[model samples]
Target: MPRFGGPEVLELDRHHPDPVPGPDQVVVRVHAASLNHLDLAVREGIPTLKLTLPHILGCDAAGDIAEVGSDVTDVEVGDRVVVNPGVSCGRCEYCLRGEDSECVEYKILGEHLPGTYAEKVAVPARNVLKIPTDMDFPQAAAVPLAFMTAWRMLITRAKVRPGEDVLILGAGSGVSTAAIQVAKLAGCTVFTTSSSDAKLEKAKALGADVLVNYKAMPWSKAIWELTGKRGVDVVVDHVGEATFKDSVRSLRKGGRVVVPGATTGALLELDARYLFWRQLSVLGSTMANQREFEEVMKLVFMGRLKPVVDRVFPLEQARQAHEYLGRGEQFGKVVLAIDTPD
Candidate 1:
């Protein structure tokens, strides 16, 4: 976007020059780019994210390798791949410890650097993973950010176990779409809330055992009653101030609430008594570490997990795509097609 404000600020620069790879980087001929709530946040100029004006906005991408750096050897040109958007200095202690998200200089694709909203983008060679020929570019693009973040939140931070009661808030989001499936595959009885009944129904097909329309009724109370007043074991909430307190309230004693992003304002107040008396764990998470990314993408490649893409738009219509997402009408992800195959 030219300047942070709204979707109107986004400009389609079709004449923008393609990127050149560094010695450790590779140039990708981008086919598809997926939108995240993060894209909207960065566009609006979050105070903490300090992005340069006229930022390119897209965190998840998939395409073919167009050029390889001299030092790159693992993959060659013409390889179909998905890019891992998280970037960290490989020399950092956190990266060495497999906690790349905590690196002193952690950067995400599009957020901290030039992003995937172009015909081509340059990313570190290690960031691209080859995808099976059967997976199309738009589908591959939908996998990176949402799946990686959800994997870390559920498996790494929440440590969700089999037969647990897990609640996923905002079933319409990309992360929640991935979270519901991940929880189900882990054998959890999932509960999810959405304002739209159609979205909730889709969540059911994704293995959500309880679907609550938060618009029609208070979701926490409904979940509490559904679980026989015992509450659930884990609550996945990224909605922030709008649902943070209710998310905490829906958890059972010693239960945890995991968050990847806060789409709503972040300054939500929490009562210390709720934390102390209930022994609840509220964990904050961002994009995944490399280890988590690889592990999760393996499942995505194996077709054991799937990405839900709500709509597709051509690159020139990126501003309209962002506005569509901002309206919260999409049931899952909104992807932009850059170099779609003939």
Candidate 2:
């Protein structure tokens, strides 16, 4: 969006030039781009972020390759692909061990670099994946950031075991929805919370075993009681200040809390006794590395893990799309359809 502050700051710049592929990058004709909480944070201008005024905002994109860079050899023009938003320095120590997200230069699309709100975006060739012919563009767009983040949080950081209990906070958001399914697929008993019953019902359809409305009762206590006071094996939380304390309380001894963001606010006053006495692990995570992204997406492509897309807005209505997500009404991802230019 042009300038940062609120949804009102979003501008449709029709005069924007189509991006050309760099030597190691390829240009995709973006058919769809999905929204994330990161988009909201960037639009409002996170303190550490310095933007160049006019910026396009979107992280997960799906489209066809319009042009391939001179050095690119894997995928060619006309390939149907989904963009992996994480960029990293391939020579770094973390990157060598396949931990691209931990690389010294690691950054995400729509965050450090130009993003995918436009009809075309140029990104590293290594960051694109070929999609099945049956996969729709909007579905592909909805899969990247949320699924990637949730995969790393539940699968890697928390190390959720089969038949274990996983409490996923904020059932309505994209990450929580994905976490519910991931936890269930891992054979974990999934517990999720939402303010709305409709969203809770939807979470059930996604295989969430226990659903709680935090508005009706304190979710930590509910989870505590549901698990017979044993607490859960793992807690997946993105709501930092509002729920971090409760998350720790809801975990059993040796349990781990995996987090991908702090939507409510980051500063948390955690009880040290809960951590030390309980031997709980608090793990911080971000977007996935390439291998993690591919692993989760394979499940998505096979129909085992579905991408939940709440709504789709045309590029011209981006402002309204941002407003909708800001209201926190969507149960999953809010997508933007990239209308082809005449």
Candidate 3:
């Protein structure tokens, strides 16, 4: 709890014994965690996050409970649960509308608040979703962030329909992987792009109807040709500065582009003319609302939607995990295994 800078700022040390649960919270011994590009950005200090120094930096995690607050009843100590991560005040206009992601005070675990990178984490009771007995911690940990995000974008925002063509801009990311599976499950034709053929093949295995090698094609012009120049119904563009313009071009007139994050860079040039001329709709999205989280995770639990995990690191090696994700070569989620009770 000392530094506030880079990965170097993430020094591990013992502060106290077990964390006490708040009136509406529970304490859990973290068993596993997963990384997102967001963690890297937080470590690098995103000015907008406005984090307190020495903040923990994990967003997705699962573990067995160690203790529960006196007021809690839905779960008990020893219950296995996945942390939802999204935090929002209960009474905002957005929350009232069930769009918790748009809450005026919306924040996420491991970002605006302390994260689950450590051996232990205390979270609001509302944040913990019970997992089926057969699911492992690593698998459960992968669901919250990526699945929720894809659910929000594909189902809620874009309202992607069956047989429609959907182009996912980045094939290697966790969200992209989830989108590929979810889009296919929704009976949509899914197209994904990856720099590596191996990753593209993996995307194909995960139900991608077509794979685009960005390294080979250079632009999405081929996507147009692949779709008979009709363009896709939706484009999931999180690659940001590098692919934003082409993403606009890859879509058909009135097509929707749902963006969750901009890994490359946030600032990008936009052609307003294209927006009006094509009657295109640019939709922005983030994590899902509570109902979306529940609906998407049900599929994960039932084995209908799968999470592709690239690798797992021990908690102490978070720095190494960050380095692995930094290479941008991983094909899916990178996880961290936190040792705890069964």
Candidate 4:
């Protein structure tokens, strides 16, 4: 986007510079890239995140390796791969400990750096993971940020286990869709809320054990009654201020609430009494580290978990795609298909 504003700000830049890889990076000829709420936030401008104008906005992508730097040995040209969006200073203590998301200089693709909206993007060698030949570009593109963030939030931060009940607020989002599958795969009974019944049905197909139409009734009350008044063990809440208090209300004593992103608004209101009396744990997570990224991708490759792509738009139609995503109607990930050279 030339300047942060609305979907109208997104313009096709035919003359945008092609990326060149650093000594330890690789240039990927992007075939597909997925949209996230982060894209919308960055496009509209986040007060704290100052960007160099004319920034590219896309986080998750999959493509063929167009060029490899001298120091890149594992991946070769023409390899099918997915890019891990999280970039960290490898020298940081958090990075050394495999907690790259906690690194002091942690940055995300399209957020702190140039992103994959273009035909070519340069990413760190360590951030490139080869995808199975069976996985198509758009499917691979939809996996990274959403699945990685969900994996870290549920598996790493929340430590959700079998038989535990998980309440994932907002069933239509990319991360929430992935979280439903992850929770199911972990043997948890999943409860999800959506305003649309059609979306609730789709969430059920993804292994959601209980579905609540938040539009029909109060979701927290529904969850309370559904769980027989015991409440859920974990609440995965990304819709922040709009539902954060209700998310807290939906949790049982000592239950955990994991937040990966706040799509609605950040400043939340919650009853401090519930936190102190119930001894609830609130955990904040971002994109996964290298190991966590690979772990979740392996599941994706194995078909144990799958990405839900709601719609696909050609690269030139990014403004339309952004507008569609902004309407908040997509049931899953919205993707942009990039036309690569022959």
Best by TM-score: 4
Residue pairs of candidate 4 with colliding backbone atoms: none
The parts of candidate 4 lying over 4 Å away from their true place are none
List the candidate numbers ranked by lDDT, top first. 4, 2, 1, 3
Error in Å for residue 239 of model 2: 1.1
The estimated TM-scores of all candidates read 0.97, 0.98, 0.97, 0.99
Best by lDDT: 4
Q: In candidate 2, which residue ranges exceed 4 Å CA deviation? A: none
lDDT of 3: 0.88
lDDT of 3 by residue, 144-179 (tens): 999999999999899999999999987999999999
Candidate 4 lDDT score at position 269: 84
Error of 3 at 148 (Å): 0.3
Q: Please give, for residues 1-342, the per-residue lDDT of candidate 2 as tens digits.
A: 767888998888888888988999999899999999999999999899877868888889999999999999999889999999999999989999999999999988889888899889999999999999999999999999999999998898888899998999999999998989999999999999999999999999999989899898889889889989999999888989898989989999999988799999999778888789989899999999999999999999999999999999998888899999999999999999988753
> What does candidate 4's lDDT look like per residue over 195-290, in tens digits?
999999999999999999988889999999999999999999999988899999989999999988788899988788889999999999999888
The lDDT values for all models are 0.90, 0.92, 0.88, 0.94
lDDT of 1 by residue, 158-252 (tens): 99999999999999999999999999999999999998999999999888999999888899989989988889999998999888998899899
Residue 299 in candidate 4 has what lDDT? 96
| Per-residue error (Å), model 3, residue 281 | 0.3
Clashing residue pairs found in predicted model 3: none
**Native-to-model Cα distance after best TM-score fit, residue 271 in candidate 4, in Å:** 2.1
